[model samples]
Target: MKSRKRKIQAPVGRAAMLSLQINMLRDECCAVAAQLMKRKTLDEVELEDCARLDDALAEAYRILRHTVAKVTLARLRRKSRTRQQ
Candidate 1:
């Protein structure tokens, strides 16, 4: 028997781009973990490590989301002021 290969696709658009990146990151992480499980044996301890890494990735993503929001709001405010002139 042979295993099958799969391809992952990402979504498009500006506002949805962030979401796509996050989803891709998660999918890649899971793929890596799945491959590891197939090649090497992991105890519960290693599984916990993977979980921790996923949590950290999520936290970093949240910070990115906040930064994007702040920058976007600043740009909108600047544009609004220009229109008032």
Candidate 2:
């Protein structure tokens, strides 16, 4: 007879997905920052590209930071509620 066991599932929550996207954006920002730093001064095209990347990175981090804070708060609340019972 074969034993039955359930397979472990990876996180599929919004926060989890956002965390992944945040990491991808972080890597992209590093690449863009390195490319920009290599040049003494940005040309018009490079300046525009750098500006867009900077804005994107800022927005990504804002959302990521908020999501992480919310998750942490929720976990703490759960723990406190259990302890109070």
Per-candidate total of colliding backbone pairs: 0, 0
lDDT of 2 by residue, 1-85 (tens): 9999987643436666776776687677668767877888856576577668767867876887677777777878988999999
TM-score of each: 0.57, 0.55
The TM-score, computed over Cα atoms with residue i paired to residue i, of candidate 2 is 0.55
Q: Candidate 1 versus the native: TM-score? A: 0.57
Where does candidate 2 stray beyond 4 Å?
1-42
Candidate 1 lDDT, 7-84, residue by residue in tens: 653222353477558767867777767766886566666667767777877886777677767767777898899999
Residue 17 in candidate 2, Cα distance off native in Å: 14
Residue 85 CA displacement from its true place in model 2, Å = 0.4
Error of 2 at 26 (Å): 7.9
